[model samples]
Target: MASNHHRLSGAPVAAAVDSAAVRITGLTRSFGNRQVLDDINLTIARGEFTALLGRSGSGKSTLLRAVAGLDHGTVGSGEILVPERVSLVFQDSRLLPWLKILDNVVLGLPGKDARGRGRAALDEVSLAKRESAWPHELSGGEQQRAALARSLVSEPELLLADEPFGSLDALTRIRMHRLLRRLYETHRPAVLLVTHDVDEAVILADRVLVLDDGDFVQDLRIDLPAERDPGDPGFQHYRTTLLGALGVLPAHRTKEQS
Candidate 1:
């Protein structure tokens, strides 16, 4: 990891004074004549959990790419200052087929302690025994758990997830949610999750933001306690509000209206 630190030396300095893990101002991205993202400005504070909700082709992924610094040549203009240490998890595990689970976690990690740290991270996610297993051998949820270990092994200051649980079954997604919350409590990394699931956002995030036509349309704060009950009137209100922002109406709300 000592050598890895040198590679991260060039990353933009995070604005710790303002408690911002990520800060973007007047950001824009275009593909030829088509503007995919337009003049977007947002800030994510340290240790804050925020979720982004948007329709398909609404520039949610584009914005996430910009913040991850993966939009280097594609970005037309603007400043995206992200924390020096950032880790991203995608809907797919994206684990290498050839590498063992342990190796996958320590992929970019350097220094002598990398393996130890990798094992510890797997243990954190309750996958210590599967360290030697192949990616194809594990179940989908287990594969995602390994991916989580890989992301957290780096102990990043900011974590960016792009619909990570979208591919899982409902029950598996629920389990992942609990695991994520536990990990957040332990590590406290600033998190920005890009998701289309209104219920998931309401259940997990401290703040939920809606993006429509390349711009932020709504910003809502979830003030409920750690143990949230979807049946709670407050949860229903948030769910209804967010669904409405996404141009959706929950089944219950529709039934009530009828």
Candidate 2:
């Protein structure tokens, strides 16, 4: 895949020591009189896994689109500075049905090395044998795996995910979480995952942020061990905190407890 066309100055620069992967200041997005994102400011450090949570229409996806440069026409004020190379994964696999899975993975990639890299990415997702298969032939989980491989094949500096696994079944989602964690360990791309599931956010992200009323309501660090259990006190505390920020009572935790 080609590098993202959206850079602050359209010029490459070296990443400063411990520099942030994404930085937004005074960012705003409006549609007529309705402002979806209001002067949001955030910084995501290199290689950090951050999860964004919010109620519907709270501007989570809007913010991500702005960061991805897909909403440039709607973006107003502020600035979004991202690394030169970037990639995005969406809720849907979004693969072309007519293209073979391998061809889809190598879509925009150039040069003789493209095929090699694409196959390697597929192998990483445990789909090496399915490269010749069609998109319609794969299960939801498999399609998602292919989507992930396609995004990672480019080796981006930052990876933006908009609820990448939200469409999967419960068991498949769990497996994808593990797969994502392993992939992050190996690739170390700065990631921003926009998700609705508070538990999923807490389980997968190094930091969890809640966006509400067009601004950040909560920014909490996960400080738990990598191997986490949802039943653990620390994990539950973070989950409760995020769920509360969204103004919803946790189904597993009572109102008073939350």
Candidate 3:
């Protein structure tokens, strides 16, 4: 494995070909006197969809950033191993306002067929026709779609998303959820989605993890059918379990009441 003692490195870890897509052992991150992540250990298998739920400042984003190699300062002793090809999507569509949608998607992409791949990616997200539109011209949800297109343009093996739909309206968020599920099915990338919404995590992930006070408090496998319905009894059970983990629901609350 590619191990770093005091800092997290994105370098590809040398492991068995059949090993997990991501592996972190004893990972810790601190900001001055505050420890954001405390000896975190996690493993994400190939093509697995895992959702992380946590309250604000609970170290969810901090852990995701460490795996993405976006955090560079003073990580405590640990090792993080991830696929060399990883893509990240943030809460806001960080597309440059000056670039057209197509340009934004294909930016820094290598190969002579980069534009073709970019167009295909846009089409996958239903944004092909809007390729020529400026970033400012699209709605918030549309801009996020463009951002998704950009993330998938490279066919990454791992996708890290940090509350990518948090800012959207309720209706738009639902639509985006459907789109994301479809894309995940189509691409089968190992996905780590960080969200504060318990229902969203239950609906989208194969397994849901709840982080509290810089450590994972719960890891629940979601065994519902792929065509998940919010009204399904099994779905409700999982949602309630996660809500209790997040302290959104009372520990003694019944599943039906959640």
Candidate 4:
């Protein structure tokens, strides 16, 4: 993991957008008659930051793969269509060892202007200076940023993120949150983020959906303002509400802090 796109660490996203970027109807998946995802009906709107919340085995990641066309269905029914493009940013950076940081970002792109696009993506994350650097040389944050650069350089129409910041420390995670929010506003892609962090979902998503036992348990539109701060009372209220939606036992708290 350390040798590859993981430099230490890391969308055309849009401002004004239209309808749902990816729509799923009766989306179900099974493993030898054991259902993993059961009747998932959801719509992810364009230019919207949406989050999928669930426990480890709730099939959140599996749903993401299905959307990405990375996995085939066994007994489900659904379609993922994109006029532009679709891409996924996994939990790990997944960089190539032989490729330089910039080259890795340009992996999917043409070699000509790949570096340029790579640089721009890095600039968005404030890691442009590390352009020529090796993946193994960067800090965890930088590596993640580089990985993001690679993902965004493709200018995807639909962006799927699977707990991209799950491994970061509190401070780093918050920083990544702010970075993502800014990039989302700038690049403006339709985002479907799958995260275990309730606070993260509240902070980053325009709408939050909870998956329980392979099906959606709660789907809520966040009425909180975009400029919401974790320290603010209104934000806290909304965060608490999201926690409740996640079926928090009132005893064990969501690991994600505001």
lDDT of 3 by residue, 1-258 (tens): 223222474444355434588888899888888988989998889899999999999999989988888776554668877776789999999999999999999999999999999999999999889999999999999999999999988888899999999999999999999999999999998999999998899889999888888799888888888778999988888888888878988888634321
Give one digit per residue, the lDDT tens place, for model 4 in 8-33. Answer: 01012222224767666667787777
Model 2 poorest 10 in a row by lDDT: 1-10
The TM-score of candidate 2 is 0.90
Candidate 1 local lDDT, 48-115, one digit each (tens): 99999999988888888878877655637777667667899999999999999999999989889999
TM-score of each: 0.89, 0.90, 0.92, 0.85
lDDT of 3 at 249: 83
Q: Is candidate 1 or candidate 4 better by lDDT?
A: 1
lDDT of 2 at 255: 38
The prediction achieving the highest TM-score against the true structure is 3
Rank the candidate models, highest TM-score first: 3, 2, 1, 4
- Please list the C-alpha lDDT of all candidates, in the order they appear: 0.84, 0.85, 0.87, 0.75
Residue runs of model 4 more than 4 Å from their true location after superposition: 1-18, 73-75, 250-258
TM-score of 3: 0.92
* Model 4 vs. true fold: TM: 0.85
Off by over 4 Å in 2: 1-18, 250-258
Judged by TM-score relative to the true structure, which candidate is superior, 2 or 3? 3
